[model samples]
Target: MSFLHLLAKKSKRRNVKLLRHLQDVASIAMKIARNGGLDERIAYIGAILHDIGKASTQFQKTLDVNFRRPPGMVFRHEIASLFFLSLVDEQDRPAVIEMVVAHHKSIFKDIGEMGLLDLNDRLRDCFEVHAVGFDIWMPNALEILHHLGLKVNPITKEVARKSFEAAVSYCEVKRIGYSKWKGLLMAADHLASDMESEVGDILPKLFITPDLNFYNQQSIWYPLSFIPGNDPRKHTLLKAGTGTGKTYFLLKRCTGRIFYILPFQASINAMYERIKKDLMDTDAEIHLLHAASLLQGNGESLKEKVLQRHIGASIKILTPYQLASLVYATKGYEALITDLAGCDVILDEIHTYSEDAQALVLKIVEILYSLNCRIHIGTATMPTALYNHLLQIMGGKEQVYDVSLPDNVLDTFDRHIIHKAEKIEDLGPTIRDAIKDGLKILIVVNTVERAQKLYRWLNKENLNVDKMLIHSRFKRSSRRALERLLQNDFNRKEKPCWVVATQVVEVSLDISFDLMITDVAPIDALIQRFGRINRIRNAHTIGKYKDIYVLPPPKNNRDARPYKLEVLRRTYDLLPEGELLQERKLQELIDKVYPEIEAPNIDLNAAFVAGKWRIRELYHAPKSALLDKLDIDTVPCIIESDVKLYELADNAIRLDMEIPVSYKILSFKNFPQLKIGNHPFVIPDGAYDVDEGLIAASLKLESVQ
Candidate 1:
């Protein structure tokens, strides 16, 4: 007798047999469940049966390269997979349903409205449509299940119909939050499909504790390194200046996998590279996570790219936005929670967040604490009230290892002399003198448009200096290349060059310059910007003050965006002119500028709250309004010419051809968009350049061909 063949995934380059895919998913799911303290058997079963619906002839036909899905034909494999729920025990049916019913979509209020519940409410023959030719496929699915060590009996159409009804009933009842079962299966399925034949070899590498002995090296210059990291406290709050080995101390505090959270992409990228280099000798897995992580890769295999986005890295450096999904209970949040549970999370530069972001970070801390994650926070400047709040959130002083430098050590970190300028143009002669002296100068603007304008003005001057401009608007590939040059070439002590950037360079860039000219920002932000200049402090560089000029705050509200005018004026007034910027006085100045930190008004949208979960169980938030409220850029766009290339290229290449833009700005412009997977809006080719980034304001829609 001949048996029918099935496929879980359609790949012309390799064998994607259904049974092998099921086994691969089951193996990964079992590992994840074990690490997250969930029931391994349930996870294994859910993973195995998640894709059994692919056994249908309809789905198999669609897998063919020449196949074209008929118009109005909606076939959900996940919904079809629900027909096999009876194969599991009655007690396990609920979890199995949760894993199967909505693994690919939301049960209710899905963005596309294609959720299981949506289809059930709209179509009277939803089950009947999925049940087409069920008799022919049922035997093959059972045989495959039996071959995978699962005991199976003949499942008739009546039995499958009842399973479908049960799954629909399970999804009908309103619940208070989301389920982890779906996330567990989704994560496993994604990993198995991505890793393919290499799943077994990669499984053992995940969730392993990294060897942190590399950070154990102590030196008198770095005081934090000498302090004992293994304390009785469950959390740590370390306050130290830049170049004081705070990162090393934080690493030394971790006893498990580490999630290093920074504020900006540039900083996260810099930290990712730094950590990978630091742990290069060990067999540690260091991954970078963000919107453009794939672009940051240096010839990493496809498997490595997948692993970078997935959980279980020894050390994963990412921005706080990646973790915000958990706070809002967005899709795949349960998987994130599962991965982050009982891990060491280091929140570096906690003071760098906006008012809304501050509230989000506080909530993130509460969630991490509930998950029993070892939280470590490090900051160069933190307001007194904010410091107290974080201490309270971390269970007060008893549970936290609070570390701060003494006045003497802080005095050694005094590295900049403040100079007030009326405007950037006012310091033209000073900038020229610095350039003539062969000094590296860093100019930081408040906005991308202003940064671009400055780069143009500098170019017009015809200055004989190596100049480069960097902001958050460039394409991923270009941005990655620029960052590499910023770190490798311009950062050299012997190289004297000029770099014009925005707030992206304000935190943790690891670049030092001889001079800095910046637009006035809030006191805390200005302090962070100051860290980028004269950053390398040592016995010879101690107490050596570099000149830093600050331009007056913008006159208009639109120009002074992203920062409150009152705070900017206060910061300017408090800045000492023609004198050393005292390291100890920074907190006092920050407190003066922001006397009291107001709690962000995001409680209404937040899923997790004051020691309780506000959202329903087994259901996720439809969308994250909090991200919009916080003013984060969540949209991607590409040049018009790249549309064809984007459609043909794989994920990594498509990401390279795309540019990240603010949704608020893009929507306001109302540019024509293309719904090709990533939903990138197509802009005129003249609007973008390889050297310059998105020129949205100068875009002429009619120029598009």
Candidate 2:
């Protein structure tokens, strides 16, 4: 018989042949299984056979750009792949079914009711439809599997039908909890599809152990550096203020691969750059993982960008949301668990999380502990109650290296004087005087609208000094540009400028300004904002203090969103008006503001509870419902003019053009949307300003350029 040529994937550039794609997936799967402590043969066999059903002419025709299926015509290749289950041993058949059955769709309660069980109920002839051309494709699939080193036996259509029936029976009787087998195949399949032939070269570079000797150097200026990190404890919890070398201290405590978690994008980016530069001499593969991580890799090649996203870097800097997927059992979670097994994870700024986020972090800590990972937590403003709770979770003092600075040492880090103002307008005279004195001024606000209004007001003053505004609403590329200016130009000690920003300036920025005039936020958030002023602490500057003025809290809940009104009022009352903001007293003041921390009631939705997995064994959640519960929904959008470039550009460029918009805003306004890569909605061009960012209130549909 003539050899049948089948395609597995098609892009605008080229078509990927089924045989080559399977080989690549199998090779990657084998390596992952070896590293993840799974059965390598099971992974390889599952990967090789995962997409064999694509050989059916029905699936092949969909590869054509002009081909469109009839309405309500549902053909699932994964369901079709199950017909050949008899090719594997009966003992291994269950595992293979888990891998191939729902690699693309869920097994039960899937979104749109498109899962296999749903298909079975909706289509009485589902088996006949999927098995239409199985007889013709069986020999071709067997030949391909045999070439890939799998032992294949000739089987008739009837035998394959029986095998499919048995697999369906097995799935129906399967127990609860997600399947690591499914996660393995999904991870391998995604990598293979994205990297194609390059998967082999990248597989070996994963799970690298980094050299952390650079952080071993001790310094008298940084007190935390004087303490030893190589203690016998399994975990470390360090309580120290900003600029005390907490990052270096936490890094010193790590012994394996590191996943450094930060709460903000600015901080994560800063840490990634800092670590990459510090470890330039080592051959460790350091990667930055986040939504805008690609924007951070401006000069890097496409291969480097691809490498940054894949699992198993020596040091991966990211936000907790990346790891939260494991808690929710999102797709590819098994691969995450496999990579994170026995690694060192650093959770920096643990106090910055909201109530719900704090509860989620606690759950993540529990899961990390179960995975045998050494957890290191560093914080400048953690409440006493929360701190003690974490201590108990980590098995108390016996198992953790709990470190804190003495009161006398903490007094030496006092760098700001606090003053209260009635409103933002009250600081107009002070801002002008500071500008006249040639001092760099930092203005922080509670909302993006306030920041923009303040920047516009300052622009009208004609102060003849550099002025810039930064918030989270700008396009990714524009945000990168603003961040560069903030770090490179405005940060210079000799340069006097005005920077008006929102809460984004709170953490991870290495910039220091001469003075700060800001809104009143939660005590912990205010403490972080104060860190930006006079941030460069040293032996000579210990006693010196820069001034930070706090404005009164907004009255209404709408104006004080993203923070509780009661908390803001309490934080304002606790401020030491016209007095030195003593570093030692901050802990007491913070505790007073947040006396009793409330544990969020989110465990009912979590997949892990009390150190045990609560989800089904081989079934994954249909969607990230936890994100919805947390009210963390954001969608990407582009201006009308950028739609053409966005559609034609590659992933990197498309990411650069995306501006993150709150899903609430889009839904409320009912903005017209466009479907393309990322499905970014379209906005009127007039609604966006390169300098001012999205003008939501000024949006008009008539001028959609």
Candidate 3:
């Protein structure tokens, strides 16, 4: 076969087309423009021509999938791109070059001279060009051109002059001086292929199909049948048991489209993998709203361009915060929210919100409704307060379907009896006993600190930890590594290992822990935790001692203590031994135990007036405090607040799926800049850091502001 055909076979494995590398530049240009870096449209065109070198037959063969950088190719590609642009009209060269030079995440170097140009309204002109050497191409650009049957000189000093002028203009506007001829080509070259659109694009398109068994049973059918295709007159609420497939129904019920909004990154990855496996066979183009969703691809140029088009996607999976970016950060949120309009939303884990967040959700609900969006709530034990809040927000209970009760939620499965621990120390012993009895146990705590403590204690006694503890605070890559290990061989394994975790395991980590020991928060929450146990049908046998244990509360004393570190308030009333509560007891337990009712402090009647706090703040709570309240790993992250990220999508620069994330907390250093994902975000108590830096608990913001 010809070399080009071989390339096509290789390219066939990669999603998207090759010419699109230029499109990555176009996206970067728009990002620059929208960000007010440069006024010239020509810069945008320059971004389109920047990666022309990738078209070389020689370059494509040299790429190895091991993620090694292409040797000596960055400047060659840049010069090739520049030479291609030079072949275009002389006037169009500047805008294109600006896009090209800055496409590899270093355009801010030009912004120092532009002095923070506000290119917002009508596109403004890049006034002054900062001087940088432009003669950047190597011997191959000329040699490859000669080989390709085109006559071209190595980009000359004069041609480099114009390119350098445009490149300088880019940095001046971003206001930060960039390194001169620093590994930019290497940076761009590192972004080797168009892989993001492959599985990354497949995730949103996948959905769970409601089985024939689901409809005959009210419990299964009600939640499983969001049926976004139906009348918009009714609001939908699903309170089915786990393994009843709350997620599947949420995904499958879209009428014209579906939006699966999950609470955590693990869920995001799991859901993405599921959708890619399931729906990618169909015609739909999928989109992921979260930053991770955007990063998982191979062809950097192809991924970059697809990200720019939003891929005209039919399904979008995301976190609520990505949507919140609209009201808070730079322009990226605009695309996310507009996409959210007019779609069916299966909001999983609706009970996870705080009062402030619930209020904000109410506002977002109104916005979605106003835009004719459909809403579906999926949770295990629907919190009364949250349900009631939705009732008031979406109109009323009768107006929305009442598929919340266990009888109506999903009839396909029987409820597993849940027990409450009489004391805290009973946990390790109980977990150990469950494991010895061949039951895989899950120990979920409300805090990462508590989870770590339990895992440490379990290890001290040498109890199995194969699935011990997982939380948001652990390194992201490491967390992913562990989840992969636990999921594949969970059931067929030997010793019982405890997965001590925060809420991260609750949503989408597919393994069923034989039993769970957890602290209580809300009824819906408790039910969700229960979902992780006995998930599949034929869960625990009748004679089996396996069941969930809600840890006992600390003795109530009025010393201003923090309520015994999330000790369940009405534990005695909810469960007695392995016996399930009877109906009357259940009602009383529901009313008295869970905090779903309007907290006395937050008025339900007043409703949120214009000035009332919003739901977006759920993501805004502090690290320590948030850690105190929920089960998540505390780590630094370089959020997409960087203007460069948006610039690539905007100006059409190539997208590399492996965008770096800080495992520790971090702050944004500049627009398009975020804290790297491997370190703790350095945040001060009094001063602000970057656009959307690590939001420390001490610093409070009322809204996305």
In model 1, the worst 10-residue window by lDDT is: 1-10
| TM-score (all chains, Cα) for each model | 0.94, 0.96, 0.56
lDDT, model 3: 0.47
Q: Which residue pairs collide, candidate 1?
A: 176-615, 176-616, 176-617, 177-616, 177-617, 177-618, 177-619, 178-618, 178-619, 179-618
lDDT of 2: 0.84
Q: Candidate 3: deviation at residue 100, Å?
A: 19
Question: Please, what are the lDDT tens digits per residue for candidate 1 over residues 16-112?
Answer: 9898899999999998888877899999888878889988887888888889989988788888899998899999988888777777787777777
For each candidate in the order shown, give its overall lDDT on alpha carbons: 0.85, 0.84, 0.47
Which parts of model 3 have CA positions greater than 4 angstroms off?
1-235, 291-311, 327-330, 395-414, 422-424, 427-429, 464-467, 492-495, 539-545, 554-567, 571-573, 581-588, 594-705
Relative to the true structure, candidate 3 reaches a TM of 0.56
Which residue runs of candidate 2 sit more than 4 Å off their true CA positions?
A: 1-4
Query: What lDDT score goes with residue 671 in model 2?
Result: 66
Worst ten in a row by lDDT for model 3:
614-623
Error of 2 at 498 (Å): 0.7
Against the true structure, what is every candidate's RMSD?
Answer: 2.3, 2.0, 13.3
Best by lDDT: 1
1-705 in candidate 3: lDDT tens per residue? Answer: 121222211343453344343344344334434332344354444444455545544444445465455553232334334435444466654434543443333222122221122221112322112112223323434443344334455665566456545544444444221221121222222223333224334233323222222222334223444433243445677655566556655554455556777777778767766765566456655555554334334333555334422523556667654444322212222233434555677777755555444444555565555545777777655556666777666667755665644553333444456776665576667667776887787777776556666766777777654654666543344555556666767644755766677777777767766777787655545566666765555434323334667875555543212132232555444556776533224434555666555433322322223433332210111123333322233333322233234334422221221222333223334222223322223323232222111233333322212
The parts of candidate 1 lying over 4 Å away from their true place are 1-4, 11-15, 64-74, 171-178, 624-630, 668-672
- What does candidate 2's lDDT look like per residue over 1-705, in tens digits? 222478887955688889899998888788878877889999988998899888777788889889888997788888878877888988998889988998887766777777777777788867887887777777777888888888888878788788778877877777755677887888778778878767767876777789999999988778999999999999999999988999999999999999999987778877888899999999799998885446566888766687676766899998887787777876567667767878999999977877878787888998898888999999999899989888888889999999999999998899888999898777889988998889999999988878888888989888888989998889888987888789888997576789999887888888889999999999998999998988886766889999999999888988888888999999999898899989899899999998987668667888888778876655666555756666567788899899999988987898889888788777766666777677887888887888888877776666663
Q: 306 in model 3: Cα distance from truth in Å?
A: 7.0
